[model samples]
Target: MTIYVNGRFLTQPTSGVQRFAREILTALDRELCQSPALRDRLGPIEVLVPQKVEAPGWRRFGLRHVPGGRGHLWEQGALWRASRDGVLVSLGNSGPLLHRAHVLCLHDANLWEIPQAYSARYRLWHRALRPRLARRAAALLTVSRHSATALAAQLHLAEDRFRIVANSAGHMLRLPSAPGVPARYGLTPGGYFLSVGNRSPNKNLRALIAAHAACGSKVPPLVLVGGEVPGIATQATAGGGRIKMLGRVPDGDLRGLYEGASAFVFAALHEGFGIPPLEAMQLGVPVICACSGAMPEVLGDAPLWFDPNDKGDIARAMRAFAHLESGKRSAMVHSGQKQAQRYCWRESARVLAQAVAGVPYQLPAGKQAARGVFGSESRPVENLF
Candidate 1:
């Protein structure tokens, strides 16, 4: 079977959805290398990209341009015309509505679950379109079991209809550390708490700020990686010089930030399946995560959980993590790395390939499970000696 991928995500900014699409596609191409026989299952695959934009090159997958404009119009018209003949795999949670043989990957039902986090237009679009697309697609995929349940209920579809293709942290290991990132951010290795970045109100940034304030100067200084800066800017210095927000950063700088942090703090609410904490885990960082949404389910006992809804609770977790002994911290890193190993982009892409090929899912030989070797070289910054 010939698989045509919706490469539109390459043009979008790197959000969770875009990140998932890119990683899965990248892994799928690599999967072709691991199992040459699998190429016969899915061959002559073309990533359909928009015109005038440079498409990502893959060893196995070919890139084809769909001419016209960008965004919804281009997807509905040019993209549909290009892939209506084959099994179109839309990784960015959407595809041509009329295309019958299609695969749609939705990360969550956040718009339905946390309606307040989205705008009227954004909510309305998904509310109206996703259900229809879910029913029309040949296969449906989600990031986690919690998300599958939430989406099934939200879309009025069967829970068994969705396949789980989880996100992983392996991608982080590929980027080399940016040497001057710590100095540029006025940071020192093992001397700062790193918070995962997102601008959404549902991310619970206000509570994070309040909690970091409560930690005071006793804990290491708190640094946020990427998030909205407008409203939070006024309160950025509210921690009495303990809080620092770096806004959005390049991937290399992010890798450096994750490597140097004493502990990784995450307080986002209603995630489909949080990826940032896993990224930290891959780098051997201890994690303090919010216990809401799919995080507890996805992270297992890898992280110290805190109530994102309560600023005091968040502060308590931070304090507890800060006071942990070196031995305890080592245990946390080991547990985190082990937990993060369960999800692999390559494995997820294999699942996707079988679905796209219209074949009954087969566990490829030697691919029974992901050993998750990406972070095998990792150790906490303090233990680097």
Candidate 2:
């Protein structure tokens, strides 16, 4: 049978979820290319997306895009019909709720956990639809163990109903960082502390701004790069130019930002799996993050943890980061790189391959083999994976 990938995410801009889907899709393509045996078992894969939207680099992955339909109508109607002879793989959350053979990847139950973080319309739609979809899916996939736990609690599903197929920094590692890209934004290399994510309330950007203000002009300037939503503009105004909000940067420039930053700071109250800090770690940049949600679970000991709700604590973490001696800073960077190494896109693809093959899914072997599918709090990723 043909394996059809829902290309709906191609119509949306690059966010954490879209990034995860793209990386996984491309890596799966690469896996099929490198492994003839696996490809022979899974059959051929094709992309079914909307014709109205621009295909985002699908050609490079050797993806055959059969463009038709429009949006949700396409996903629930045309895509479902197309899957009559195939297994539909909907990698980004929503899909045809009634399609039993469709595999669903629900990144997080963010709307249920942090209602204020989303718009009323967005929240309403997700709340009404996600649970129904989750209940009907053939196979459920999620990004982190933290997310799986939260989702299981919300949907009343068994933990094993969802498989955790984590994200990787491999794509960022492959991108070439232009030397002049940081300068294009008037940022001096290694002269700034970086934060990247949507400016939603649950992101706790206001607290980050307050903490940056608390730093009292001694710390590096804070660079905010992500979607420039209305909720963030007001809190950002309090920065008095100490914070630069450059919304939605190009991939090359984003790489430069990661490469040039002294440290990456993430203060989000929740995440399915926070990717920016991992990207920073991949670039050999140190990270300071709030010890909440999956940040600690995914980051391990690589970041300087702080209380996201406490601005003073955030300030203390920043000060601690700044006051760290060069040797200590170097050690943190090294640790971060080591931590970042645990996530591999190819490994994620291997897990997806097993799911597609109707075999028992197993996480790809890492340097350490003792790790569970999702590393436990007691074991570091290096020891677990």
Candidate 3:
């Protein structure tokens, strides 16, 4: 069987979905090269990406462009025609051909379910294209059970149409910061509460800033790691001293920020599954997260949970986290490490490989088979893995 993976997401920088795509593809490549069973069953994999973009390290495959340069016209028309020859799987939503037995990894239904959290353009795009994508996909893959339920409820997809493949901690997990690197960025060795991601409304940055202000002297300054300066300029703090926006740091530096932070904070209103919190957990950083959405699902009881809507509640949680004794902090770190262990890129790749290989993909009703696949079973799906 020829399996073509849409690699557009891998070309982008490290957002949650981009990270998910890159890691899974890398893992799949490694498995195919190293594992005899996977090599025999899957044959060779092909990655289809936008023209001119290169994935430097992937071994057995190379890049191919969809003909035509008409932008969205090309994605909707030309790519569909180009992808008709094989089983195409899109890492991001919106696969090309409707009739070609394609699998789509739909990260979230947030744009449809919680339109208020997104910008007008985003809402419009989701409204127009997402339903069509959901309807056309042969099977669906999502990062969490929450997302699966949301996709079924919002898009009216059958529960059996979707599967859950949780996100994994990156290659940086548990790795220590490079020596003296913090000094180069003018950061104190252990000075700030690290917050990664964009300043979009759904990320709840406004409330996070409010809570940071409310925390007074108890918490350290908040350090933001990614997003465009021009797009988020309006949200910048007045003095710009208390809030440090480092923009896009390289993967190595980001791991340093994760390792050396006083604590990691995430305030997103919703997520398909929160990856950064788990990233923090794997690094042994204490985490403070909002109670809503998939944050609780990802963090469990490991982090300090707060109501995202209430600035006062978030402030209280930060204050409590600030005063935690050494023993309590260690316990939180230990719990977070355990929680982070439940997810892995190799396992995620195996599940995706099975889906791509046509291994009787089925999604049973009401969490029966869903729980079995995504639940406490850490063992890889025997036949596929």
Candidate 4:
């Protein structure tokens, strides 16, 4: 039987979910070439993609273009029909519901956990399609245990139904940090606090800004690199440009910014497996994220945790990092890299390969762990991955 990778992620703007799909394919391709056992067990593997996508260039997974529409229409109609003979692996949340021999990696229960983040259509589609997809898939995979439990409760499935195939920060390590980024942004090395995420409701942007405002200009400036939220300009005005919103940076520049930061901050109310913190840790930057969601679980003791709901608490964490003792700050960098090292795309691919091949694989220890991570060369990535 063939194993078909769902390639719709190639078309969409990247979030953490799209990053998961891309890296899993890259690592799984590596596994097929290096591991004879896995290669033999897995017969022919192909990426069943639409005709329109600029698919990743992979040696092992052959690309088969199926003609049809785009988005969910394409995945459900064309891609589904093309891969019916084989097991379809959909790494992002959406997939063909009619296909029973499927493997899906649902990133979070965001629609249910934070309903304000999505439009009603997106929520309705996810609510309708995801549970059916999960119920029918050959394997249901998620990023972390917190996500697994949330998804199980939301989708009305058993906790045991989901498997963990984690995330990592090797992609950030892959990029040669671009030196021009700091000069272009007029940022001093180690004199800015970096927070990367979109202006979605779950990002807790309002409170994050409020905290930064409370911290005042005595601390490092707050640098936000993603889309803008409403009233952010007004908030920034209060701080006198102390909060800089440089929307959506490229991977190379992002790596540079991460390397030059005094600290990395994340204020998400919910996350399945937070990728930005992991990315920061990989670049040897200390992280301070909300104590909520998967932060405590994914980051372990590496970060100085704060409650996302409390702006005062966030202010304290921000100030704490700014005024951190040199010795303690170095300790944070030390533990953070150690924690980040625990997650590998190869190991994740091993688990995914096993699920695809009907074999059980053991997971190495650690919390879950992507890029400074990019592959497609023609177009630039604008989403917060």
Candidate 5:
């Protein structure tokens, strides 16, 4: 049967959610190229979006834009009618509430877990909408096992209702080396530390800044990426230019940033599934990740870990990572690459295709059996990698 994708994510900006949608769709196209079995089971994958709005990467996939409403109105009106007869897949957070054959990818339970971190309006909308969507959806897709567990617990639903399809760093892999991009950012390979994300409180940016300041002037300058700056301007300025804010950057520039950094630092208190660490690992950059949430489960032992809550611990971890011998750093890079390979966009697409094709659930293929791939635990339906 033909699967219609909810094109709402196309109207959104290029954040983690949008990135996941784009990468997965591109990979799904590639997967279809290699798997004739999948082709027989699933018909043409089509995306239905609203007309007149510019969708940056829509041309990369099978896009069909219908003229009518915009935003949620379009989703509820045109999208609902378009997806009435087929399986509708909403890769991002939201979907039409009335659709029953819909598969919704709820990236995380952060809205429920850390309600205070989100604005009142966004939190209220998600709180009201998601539970109902979860109940109505034919199946739920999430990025990490941790998120699946957290979402199941928070929604008071069975864990089998959710499938864990992890994210991949394939988009940044094998890119043309961006020589000028690094120069534009005033960075040198292996000369600076890096962190990316918005200024949300849950990102713990202030704590990361505090940790950088405590590390003293001898450490490499800490570079903050993403569009949101938060309240760190004063502190960043007072540190005698120890912190460099690059603001939002283009996708092409990101690979250069990852390749040039001494180590990537992710201090977020919670993530549905941490992507930056995998991005860094894919580019052969060492990573320092927070011990909270899914960092441990996703990155495995490939990264140096620290407590997101304790500024001292973060500082200490950075310091130790900086002082690691060359031999050790190379070892970490090798191990990280192996860990990064465990996740692939094509694999994610195959699993999603399986779900869309109404096949029985199964874990993503990996280093071992589904049981070992998902860390020795099997769920009622099937374990997700």
Candidate 6:
């Protein structure tokens, strides 16, 4: 079977979606290649990727040579043609062709929920493309049960059409705490709370900053890692001490920050599946996150929860995490570690391959014609094994 995976997201910085695409594809290529069940049922699998990506190491899953230009027109055309042979799976927002038997990994509906987080042009593009992509998809994949439910509710998609595959921590599972990292970032050792992610409006960073200031002297300094620092407003506080913005730290440094922090903080108003909190958990750091979207689903009772809308609530959560005794902190860390183990890339790949292999070749009404290069399934769409 030929599987064309949209690898565009892989080019982005290491984040939830990029990591998902890269890790899952790598795992599938390595593990599924030797699976007797997959081999016997699906025959030899052919994976297609963008041509510009290097194929020697880590890039070999599928690279194809599509012309690079404005608006991704050439790449989309290439994907459409390549997908003609068999099932196509898009790992991001964009889809390849109109009528192919395809699977779409719609990570979240963040654009619709928080339009202010994105620019007008981005929102317009999403509004135009998302519905068409969702309607055309043979099966929809999401990063969390929360995301699955949200997509179904927002897009009015049938429950059975969606598949929930949670995101997992990357291969760098753990990071040892380095003593001088705090000093390098001009922070006291074990005297700061860590927050990581892009500086988009949905991150609710302004609220976090307000909450951190409201905590007064009891809470440690707030260290924000990742995203470009906005030049418009001064992030520094009234006392000249501000939320330390360490924009886009290297992976090793990020791990150090996570390990050495008093607690990990996430203030996002929405997320498909929050991964940074899980990463912090693996690093033995206690987490404090907003009690909404996939945050509660991902963290459960493992992390300290606060309402994103209430600055006082966020401050309270921060103070609680900051003042917790060593024994209590240790317990939270252990619980978080156990919770983090629930997600894995290998299982994600297995389920994804199953979904793609099981999709019927016959295209549905208003959907594109499914080329019969692959055999049909005797079982119903809901009952495919």
Across 224-336, the per-residue lDDT of candidate 6 in tens digits comes to 88663221112332224757877788777777788779899999889988888888887778989899889888877899899999999999999888778999989999999
Clashes of each: 0, 1, 0, 4, 0, 7
Give the TM-score of each candidate: 0.88, 0.88, 0.89, 0.89, 0.87, 0.87
Off by over 4 Å in 3: 97-99, 174-176, 229-239, 359-381
**Deviation in angstroms for 243 in model 4?**
1.6
Q: Give the Å error, residue 221, model 1.
A: 1.8
lDDT tens digits, residue span 183-259, model 5? 78777767899897866777888899889998986579888877642221122222236888887788789888988
Index of the highest-lDDT prediction: 4
Off by over 4 Å in 6: 33-51, 68-72, 97-99, 174-180, 228-240, 361-385
lDDT of 3 by residue, 89-155 (tens): 7887665645355788889877765576665665676578777877767677999888888888888
List lDDT for all candidates, in order: 0.79, 0.79, 0.74, 0.80, 0.79, 0.73
Q: Candidate 3: deviation at residue 53, Å? A: 1.3
RMSD value for candidate 1: 8.8
TM-score, candidate 5, is: 0.87
Q: Which regions of candidate 4 deviate over 4 angstroms? A: 228-240, 359-385
Q: Name model 2 segments beyond 4 Å from true.
A: 52-69, 228-240, 359-385
Better of 1 and 3 by lDDT: 1
The regions of model 1 sitting more than 4 angstroms off are 178-180, 227-240, 359-385
| Candidate 4 residue-wise lDDT, 1-385, digit = tens | 6778898777766667778888888877876677654554666788877766675777798887788987789999998899877677899888888876778889888878888777667777778888888877778899999999999999989999888989888878878977668768889888899989877878887898889988887578888887643211212222346888787788899999998899999999999999999999988999998998877888999999899998999999988888889999999999999999999987888778667654112111331111111123312211111
The pairs that clash in candidate 3 are: none
- What is the model-wide C-alpha lDDT for candidate 4? 0.80
Model 4 CA lDDT for position 144: 93
Error of 5 at 325 (Å): 1.2
Better model by lDDT, 1 or 6?
A: 1
